[model samples]
Target chain A: MRNLIDVTDLSVAEIDELIATAEDMIAEPDKYAQVCRGKQLATLFFEPSTRTRLSFESAMLSLGGSVLGFSEANSSSTAKGETVGDTVHTVSCYVDIVAMRHPKEGAPYAAAQYSEVPIINAGDGGHNHPTQTLTDLLTIHREKGRLDNLTVGFCGDLKFGRTVHSLVNALSRQKGINFVFISPEELKMPAYIKENTLDKNGLSYEETASLEEAMPKLDILYMTRVQKERFFNEADYIRLKDTYVLDPEKLETAKKDLCILHPLPRVNEISIAVDSDPRACYWKQVKNGKFIRMALIMKLLELQL
Target chain B: MKIDSIQDGVVLDHIKAGKSMDIYKYLHLDKLDCSVAIIKNVRSGRLGKKDIIKIDSPMEVDLDVLGYIDPDITVNIIRNGVRVEKKHLALPEKLVNVIHCKNPRCITTAESQLPAIFLLSDAQKRSYRCAYCEAEKTRRV
Candidate 1:
């Protein structure tokens, strides 16, 4: 049941293979158009997501595969209170693969227990989202030309960001990867991630609250929104909210090739002024998501052009 | 409960239902030369169902290990065809560094200096969670 419940489910070698396929898909789209003819993809999103649902539909459509799914729990049998395992078991009968998103953590993993087809976790509530992790990896590989020997800085709400945790888990498997965690004291990275993923792997990393101080030393800066709710008090939020925002002023100390990345729907975390900068790669990440998903669909279906 | 037909043996009473094997293995009863009888699913007044392990000969048992695994267990020392002494056990409420938390979000995961402490969350379900993060302890089926 080769399900991607977590980013760690795929090895570094497997990720490289997926990346190679994604590159091939990017270079030549027509050659792989009819690879999944007559295949049906079920995008079982228990939570509503415009970009992610569209990404999966677009990827399946690109591969000549049709898509079927409900956009929210209201439209599905789950509205009547069906269990995730039962819904997935029934969906497996009609679809070749399953991509699920839920509001509860570990919902996809629970679905995988009964699903007969391959299960892909689109996103879960503050939990593993391997596809987004794959998108970040594909973008990083394409932008930097290597996954190793680079310093990556993750800024903002590290405690609740599933994307940061997934990326850190994946990157820790690579060689010579140094991590710089930049965030306010309240939003600092969780100890479990630090102990289990980084230190347990014998990886080197340092923590800082100043994104500007870590800017010049970084090869990649992955930015995440720090919601005001993550802070304990208004005083602390006012004191620290602006420190992580990437702006033209912050770029003065950064390297010319410093690739700035952000998981989308930015709310002033990266100033509007920095979008025009040559280093902004968050939009590129959105595009790479489709290609990487295309590669993942083919890899999971075991289809070839 | 009394092993009326036997002489000079030890009796373990009021073990949680189906936990006799844990006690059996903990005491290394498999390699013992004496006859060992493990009674399972025995009816009890306090507990609806329980298990009992009886050693056919007098032997020294580690009460600390037994108490930690199940506090409800009581050991009856039998010698010369008579019950000599009964030892009751009391386990501390918090277990420290005895087991690790399975939760990925637990504080003990990163703070290597902090001890992994777990508290019994559900006695009937036999479930425990980390004291810091309060993640439910998962058991191997």
Candidate 2:
């Protein structure tokens, strides 16, 4: 594919290939260090995102490639009201690839239409985040050595969590994957997603308000922050923010091999005390994010590792 | 009373009743400098009531959009006041720049230059989704 705009853009085989490539990068990092030598990656972030932007930059740098472009729209020609198409066209002339994060849902898609270079969607407005999905996939592959037959529990904000949606969509394609959605009533998984991704695929899934009850049966626990930004009302945000914090007490009943994952910049969803737990692989997930991005950049650039 | 047949033009027949105005606006029929007639709530054997638009000038119309709005629509071509050819419409596989995506965060909303495209994802449900954001197209704007 010319661009990685959504998780669905990658097929099951391609995801496996990426995971394998990521594993190779982890084992022998030096061999792939200079794969992207003399190349340039433009990071055009229209919104404020520290982790995703940095991870992309780090991925490129580790591959012996250079990084350019703006971290914010106001810092770039976008402040002058330059269109995404125009910006992409201009940036494509200078860079080999682009990793764009925008507040607009399909801004990267619009850019991809005009870009001569490969475009990677770092994040979009509550839309799909394919790279994070990749990161999660790699993490799961490393932790459990398989993507199938796992009872995965998604805790906290499943409604507005783009990561949850992307991961669910990706994982649903795997065989024997059952979803245990743990969230409050107000933050239940959207019907369209349930209908289109899960129900359409004939995937098994169940919903519950209690994370504790779901913990024992879960092979993987994917926790997401209840975003204050997604809430329109302060009262609702306050009420739901602390609904499902993954403390030591909550993790007590979880399986010893239950791999806990989270897309970082987490806002008090997982407690600090649980960080030392063997199952808490979120930190490793972050590192895996960089490795997978490196793999993806290499794949998009058609460089053999 | 019977509406006069156009000598050389197009006839949009079997439009769902009350939807002719939307089609007129969508096609910019008002902007056409030709004789145009809209017959609304006309009795028909196939359809209990329907709307028909007769344009007395030969011009290109977006059949795909017509299909999207109402797949049951029939487009009849008139030549020398004779019904030469008739065409039926079904939902197009993909529609480009036909309707704006309503999602506020959709790329088309931010970049006006980008054509708002929708793909017919669910044929049974007649559901279309924005090609860019994958947001379901609820209505035409």
Q: TM-score of every model?
A: 0.72, 0.96
Give candidate 1 regions above 4 Å deviation: A227-243, B3-141
Give the Cα lDDT of each candidate.
Answer: 0.82, 0.90
**lDDT accuracy of residue A152 in candidate 2:** 94
* lDDT measured at residue A114 in model 1 versus the true structure, 0 to 100: 80
Q: Which candidate is the best by TM-score?
A: 2
Question: What's model 2's overall lDDT?
Answer: 0.90
- What DockQ does each prediction reach against the true complex? 0.06, 0.80
- Itemize residue pairs with steric clashes in candidate 1: none
- Runs in model 2 lying further than 4 Å from the true structure: B1-4, B139-141
Docking class of 2: high
lDDT tens string, model 1, A60-167?
Answer: 999999999989989999888677778899999999999998866666766776899999989876666789999999999999999999999999988777789899
